[model samples]
Each structure stands twice: as structure tokens, then as C-alpha cells.
Target: MSELEEAPPESGSLAELARKYGLRPAIARPRPGVYLRQLWERRHFILTYATSRNVSRYSGSALGQLWQVVTPLLNAAIYYVMFGLILGGSRHIDNYPAFLLTGMFVFTYTQRVVTSGAKSISGNLSLIRALHFPRASLPLAYTLQELQQLGVSMAVLVLIVMLTGELPTWSWLMVPVVLLLQTSFNVGAGLVMARLGASVRDLNQLLPFIMRTWLYASGVFFAIHDKVVVSAGLPEWVATVMYLNPGAAFIEWMRDLLIGSHDLPRTVWVACVFWAVFALIFGFWYFWRAEDRYGRG
Candidate 1:
């Protein structure tokens, strides 16, 4: 046989040997711990990106960052008019403006995070292609951006609550705890939407409607406990399920802390903790699974 034909089989065994000896893939999927460490190492970049984006968002607006507070305030006014006055949804609630605005501010934070995160990866294609940082940074930075805006809006919310005759109490200390849990939940939601939006471009369009439905169902403008559970005569289990909604749970926690609402179910606390932990774990794994595919298209 010719020398070429006499050579050892270069197809299967040799290919395996070559692969075994070759340099490791530059973009191979990382172990979970390693991936998390990489993300932590890049935290500064995430913060800087978040800060810059937050500033730039309002750079052109006439009122600048004031719009953050004003936008939600406007929504609260409309809801107050429609749901509180026109629809009589606030008939059973005391200090309906405080209750309505509390829910609006808290819920809007998550809404913005989810919607912005859905576009984080797809919107930052250029940055993803140009940078070697962890892809998680995009969603993380976006969430941080929303968190900062929420912080500003929250200051205004506190003043609004004061104006509505709700004064600070010892229970207000729990605000930080609730905020921590909700931030965890928001980050996870953002990560999940980032992956989904990267794969399904239409998700960006669908999120607004989905969030609106979620807002109403979350009892933003009315007392869900009174309307759904007590007045409507929902079954115990059904009311329990509604109380378990993460959005409503967070809002309930805030109302309890800020407005002295004493009707919060203990189960809402459990649901808040469960959703925060579950979402973070599942969302991180889900987003990391497709890390290598992010910028391919």
C-alpha cells in the first residue's frame, strides 16, 4: 500500500487522541462555582454600567431623574381616579392613596427590572460581542439600574406616605428586609427574561401586557384581601393562593410596614422567602446553561 494508505487510521481513534491533547476550548462552559466567581470578579463593571445607563436614561428628559418619581406618581393619580373614585375599588380600604401608591412604587420596581432585563442581552449585542465579561452582567446591570431608580422613587414614596398621614413606626425597620428579598426576586426575574428575550425576540413585546395583568392581579389599586378573599367569598385555599403571589406578598409586606395594615397573612412572608430563593437558584442555572450561545447570532 502507498505510504498514505499505510498510515494509521486518522479518522476515529486519531481524532479522539487529537482532541484529548488539544488545548481546551476557550469558551467551554464553566463549572457553576467558577462561573459565579467570574461574575463576582466583574461586579465593578456591572455597577459602572448600571450607573451610567441609569444616568443616561434621563439625560435628555427635561426633569432628568425627577421623572422616575413623577412617572409612577402619575400612574398612581390615574389609578386613584379610576379605581378609587370612578370604580369604587377603594371603598373598604383606609388611606387608599397611601395603599395605592405603596403598591405602585414597589410593583413598578419589579416591572421595570423585568421589562428592561428582557432586553438586556438582545439590546446589548454590540457590548456582548465586543466584551469577554460574563453574560450575566448584562441582566445584573439592568436590574441594578432599576434598583437605583426604585431607591429614588422610594424616597418620594415615603414623603407621599407621610403626606397621606402615615407616620414611621418600628415596623418600618422591616422595609430593608423586604427590599432585600424583593431585590433577589427581581434579579432572578431579570435573568430569566434575559435568556428568554435573547431566544424569543417577541418576548419584549409581550411583557407589557403580561405585567399589566400581573399588576391588576397583584392588587395594586385595591385591597386584594378585602375584595378577593373577604368580600368575594373566595375559598380559603383560593385566597391563600392569591396571597402567595410574590408581587402581592411584597406589597403587603410594605403596606404592613409603612401603612400599619395589620391584616397581612403570615403565609405571605413564607411565600416571599420561597419565591426569592427559588427564583434566584432556578434563574441562575437557567441563564448559565446557554452562556455559550448568547452572542452567536
Candidate 2:
């Protein structure tokens, strides 16, 4: 028999078995592939735009990227006065400014992901029609931009905490873990919205309303404590609802880690993990299903 025919069936079966059991297959072995040529062709353009975004934001102005820091500070001040001082979140949170800033920063990342991703493909229509790349990259770029913003915001937050006497303990190391979970959720949700926005287009208009509703529901303007008593004394269901909100969970989890609070519960962590995994899988699958349509005018 020829060498190919003489080879034992067990060798091939064993290799397949190894793959089935989650072993990494050698790259030389052909595997089911994505559209590599398309990805490669468009990667340079995407990277060039991404780099240009980073550079242009800091190129001309004296303050440069300091605007990122300044913008959030101004936002915090406005919200602190409007909500914490006049409208009264101070009654709930001990340090209302800190709490509001944390909530605002975290929730803003989610909002950025949702809003920008929703317009990613549609907003880049000229490039989309001319280039044959993964439409997913548009949303991915938005997510990275938000992540860059988050890094700057978090640094400012750390300085604020230090000045305010909320010194970091070893527990603060959990910030990255919390951030990773949060990013996973954002990426998944953004992917879904990217496709939906491209297909429906009207979703672009509704996104801001959705974000506004989410902001209110997320407890950014209030505390998640059981301070409000029910008329029928229904117990703490409102607080439960707040904890269940993904935005609230992310913010509170960050607070627990960054501000050294113990208010977040195990259930919140579990729920966040569940949503992160579900969103990532579901969103990517749906986006890939429509891959062929992304480059069409």
C-alpha cells in the first residue's frame, strides 16, 4: 500500500480527538477559516484611522488630551450640583460626588459603546461601499475608542480618590477584573447594535432614548440602597431591581473594588458574568451571519 493508505486510522482519529478535547491544532494543518484576505486588505485602513483619531485629538490644542480629563470633571460638577446638591442624591450617598463620578464614568462607557456602535457601519458608508473588510471592525474600533477614554477617566478617578482619602487597598487590584467583565459586556452589546443599526437604521434614532432610560434605571442619579420605603411595605424590591441592572452592577462592582465598599453582592457578579458571556457569543454570531452584506452600498 502507498504511505497514505498505509497510515494507521488511529493517528487521524487521535488528532481529531485532541481537537475535540480542546487542544490547539497546529497552524500548518488547515482549519475552517474566516475571510483572511478581506481582513488583511482592510486592516491597514482601520489602523490608520484609529491612529489618526488618537493623534488628532492631541495634535493642535495646548491642553491636548487634557480635554478628556476636563470634560468629565465638568460633567461631574454639573451633575453633582444638579443631582447631589439641588435634586438631592447627597441624601443617599455619603460622598455623592465620588459616587456620581464613578457611576457616570462607567455608564458613559456603555453608552459610548451602544451609541457609536449603532452608527459604525452606517456612518462609514463611503468606506463600507469601497472596502471589503469585516463590518465588525467598525464597532470594534468604537469599543477601543471608549476604552481609551475609560483609561483616562479611571486615572483621574484614582487621583480624586487619593485626594479624598479613599486610599487603595489590595482589594483595588480587582479593578482590572471588573473592567474586563465590563468590556466583554460592552463589546457583545455593541456588536449586536452595530448589525441592528446597519440593517434597521431607525435604531440609530431610538438609541439615545434607550440610553437615557438606561441611565435613569442604572442608579447614576440615586443610590442603590433600600432607603425608600414602599407604601405597602413591599420590602426592598427597588434595590433589587437596581442591583439587577447591568450598568448598576458594573458601577457598583467597580465601587466595591475601587472605593473599598462591600455593598455589592455575589449575585451581581454572577449576573454580570452571565450577561458578558451571553452577549459575546450571541452578538458575534449574529454579526458574522451578516458579513456578506456589510460592504454592499
Candidate 3:
């Protein structure tokens, strides 16, 4: 009978016993702290990926890197014509160009990060399957790519602000702080979207519509505070909620810094900090929970 039951029990080594029972080392989920440490260890890879993406994004195009600046400028021009000129969105607003550009630039950063993050997982399935690195690196890399693009775009925005007669001032120093808060929010958003998109591939198709709606709601084309709150006589709580919107808060903060608009309300600052922290903590935990399932069918 098959070499007398395959051998003596004493000769069964641990590996043989494991194979006989179809048992192997348990693939326990990593502890959160360990996962984070692993992610930190891969920070250089993340940065390199981000830098590579930023540099190569327009490599095939005739203008190459100029498209980054041109894309947003084109959008700004279209919005200026449609909303500013045709719809009178800029009515009663001084320095409308700077106002619109600041909002567009700030909000675009979040939009790009989210859209790119959504694609990060689904688009890199092959790499995920082949590599043993942390999956969070994908979304983080995309966020950093968008952040690099934002840095370039901000230079163009600053020039636009100056040309529109809004000189740089001490308030301009606050721009980096606002950008940092928004970057944190974008990272969290990217993580959440990466997980969601992997599970529901249709999310990529729907993100553009969602982001478009968000853009309008974010006061990118008009002054929500002046046009809606002051003119519509909306209740105070509603205004508070609108101002607290992370997108609107960021856009308004940039406007204040770039155009000498009214100081951002204390509540807006609180809201920015709150959203940044909340999104990051929740997003990371949510994403980490699904780590083992990332590449599975």
C-alpha cells in the first residue's frame, strides 16, 4: 500500500507533516503600527514614483510640461467667459480674475488628487500582484504627484494674482499653511477613493461628475459668501456649514491671502484642521482594513 503508508511517524518532519495536512503558516494581518512602519520604509519609492509621474505625464505632448499650466488656464478662461462675462458671476467683485484663479487653483489640487487616487489601485493591478510593498504607496504616490503639479501651478497663479494688481503681502505667507492642510485632506481622500475604486470599478466613471458638482458647490466660479449668504438672507447655520466645507474653506482662505479679501473666519480655520485630521485618520484605518483583499479577485 503505497510504500507501506509512506513512512514511519518518527520520520515525518515538520515540513512533511505540514504538507500532509495541507497546512502552512497562518497569514495573519499585520498590526497597524507595523504596517505604518513598513509604509514609512517605502517613502523613497513613493516619492520617486510621484516624481516620475509628474515628469512623464506630458512627455508625449508637443508642449510637454507647459500643458500643466495651460490646462488650468484654459479652464479659467472658459469659466471667466461663461460665468464671469455671460452669467455675471463676477458682478460687484473687484479683482475677479484673481478671485476666480485662486479658487480654481486651490480646488483643482484636491480634484486631481482624488481622481488620480481613484485610479491608483485599479490601474496598477499588475504591479500590486507582482510586488510585496504596501498598497498605500500607490495612493500616496498619486497624491504626491498632484502636489508636485500644484507647486508648479501655484507659480503661474501667483503671477496671475500679481498681474491682476494684487501684490504679495505678509498674508501671502499663509498660503503654504493652507496648502498643507488641503494636502492632508487630499491624501485622506485619495486613500478612501483608492479603496472604494478597487471595490467598485464604476467609481472611476462617476468621479468626473462628482468632482464637477463639487467644483460648483465649492464656489470656484463665484463668491458664495457675498452672492448667497449676504444676498439670499440665508440663516447663520447654513452659512456656517457652507464656510466649513473643506473645499470652500480652502478656496476662501486662498482668496483672502491673494486678494486682500476679508480675513477667513475662525470657524473656517477650525474646519480645515478638523477635516484634514479626520479624513486622514479615518481614511488610513479604513484602507488598512482591506489591505489583504487588494489584489484578490
Candidate 4:
């Protein structure tokens, strides 16, 4: 054979050619470790993105950022009248206003993270196709945005709690811990929602109903044990299951912390830790598994 003769014209498919050249698809799925590292590397970008979105979120409104605190307060007021008064939710609880508001603000954080996350991937098709960064960043940023907004809401919550006659105590120090746990859960769940929202056509439409059902079940407007186990005479385990729900777990924890009279058993803390770990692990893996298919048909 002639030395100049090309080595049998390098045969096989384009994939083989790519393999031979040490090349990979531009949008190829990365290993789990690599994907997470990528996300960590882009932390600053995610923060900036989230901050920008949050700033722009209510910028168009006449009231501007004041709406952050106002929106949840108004929602709480409506729920107070409807559920606390009309439906008799305040019957067995002392300082029902604080209880109701705590639940509302806490649950709203999760709801917005999920609802926005569900649209993160689908709604950012242009951005996804145009860029090569980790898709998880979008949902993570949305989570951060909600978290920042929650900071403002938290200040207002403290004011309202005091106005409703609750005294601050040493237990209040644990507020950040509860938030850290719920944020973990939200991050995980948001990733899951981001992936699903990207693929499911009707998910956006169904999200409102799902969120509403979650709100009702999470003891947002009333006490779970009082309403379910005592009033309805349902099984104790029924209320237990509701407490185990991540949203309920976080909300209850917040209520217990902010409202001194609202005491709960040790199990709710366990639920918080459990859901935080479970959701983060499962949601991250599930979303990463579908990484390569995000923007394509």
C-alpha cells in the first residue's frame, strides 16, 4: 500500500467520526456531577438573573415593589374574611390572623417558585436554544427571585405578627433554618417542575388548580388537626399526612416560630428535613436525566 493512501478513507457514521475526533454534541447531556458543577459555577449569573427578574416583575405596576408585601397581605386578608370569618376557621385558634398570615406567606413562596419554575424552561425556549448553560439555572434563578421577594414579605410578617400581639423569643432564631429547609425543597421541586413544564403542554393550564388544591390541603387558611381530625373527625393519620406535605410542613414550622402559641410536635421538623432532602435529591436527578431533550422537539 502507498504511504500517501488515506487510511481506508476513515469509515463509519458521523457519530464514529465525532468519537474519533474527540467531539460531542453541543447540547449533549452531561454527567450528574458535571451538571451540578456547572450549576455551581454559574451561581453568580443565576443570582443576577434572579435579581433582575424580581426587579422587573412588578416594575410595570404603579405601586412598584411595594406590591411584594402588599400582594400577600391582601391575599391573606381575603382568606381571613372568607375562611377565618365566613368559614369559621378562627374558631379554635388564638390570634388567628397571625396564624393565617404566616401560612399564607410561607405557602406563597413555594407556590411562586413552582409556578414560575414550571414555566422556566418552556417559557425560555429562545434563551435555552440560544445559550448552552445549565438548564437548571433558570429554575434556580426563579427560586432565588421568590426567595428575595420573601425577604421583604418576612419583614412585613414580623411586623404583623407583633401587631397581632405575639412576642419575639429565642425560638425566632430558627426562622432561617426553616427557610433554608423550605428553600431546599423548593429548589428540588422547582427543578422537577421546570423539566415537566418544558414537556407537558397542559401543565401551565393545570398548575393553578393544582396550586389551589395544595393551598387548601396545606392548612394555609386553617389549622390542619383542628379542621381535619377534630372537626371532620377524620383519621389522625389524615392530618399527619397533611403535615408531612412539604408545603404544610414549612408553613406549620413558620407558624410555630412566629406565633408563640402555635406549638407543634417534633415530627414536623422531621418532615421538613425529610422533604428537603427527598425533594432536592429526586428533583435534581429527574431534571438532569432529561437534560439533552430540553429545547428540541
| Candidate with maximal TM-score | 4
Cα shift from native, residue 85, model 2 (Å) = 1.4
lDDT of each residue in 1-297, candidate 3, tens digit only = 686576555645877998889986443357899989988999999999999998899999999988878888899999999999998888878889998888888888899899999999999999998878889999999999988888889999999899988777998898899999999999999999999999996998899999999898888888776767787877777767888888998888888888875456678888888999999999899989988888779
lDDT per residue (tens digit) for residues 177-247 in model 2: 88898899898999899888888868987877888899887877676563443322445766777687898
Q: Which 10-residue window in model 2 sums to the lowest lDDT?
A: 25-34
Tens-digit lDDT track of model 4 for 1-297:
788885654446766888989998898989999998999999999999999998898889999988988888899999999988898889899899999889989998899999999999999999999989999999999999999999989998999899999999999999999999999999999999999999899999999999999998899888889889889999999999999888899999899898878978578999999999999999999999999999898
Encode model 1's per-residue lDDT on 225-277: one tens digit a residue: 67877888887777678779998999988888898754788899999999999
Best by lDDT: 4
TM-score of each model, paired residue for residue: 0.93, 0.80, 0.90, 0.94
Worst 10 residues of 4 by lDDT: 6-15
Ranking of candidates on TM-score, top first: 4, 1, 3, 2
- The segments of candidate 4 whose C-alpha lies over 4 angstroms from its true place after superposition are 1-12
**Lowest lDDT 10-mer window, candidate 3?**
3-12
lDDT assessment of candidate 2: 0.76
Tell me how far the alpha carbon of residue 70 in candidate 2 is from the true structure, in angstroms, after superposition.
Answer: 2.7
lDDT, each prediction: 0.89, 0.76, 0.88, 0.92
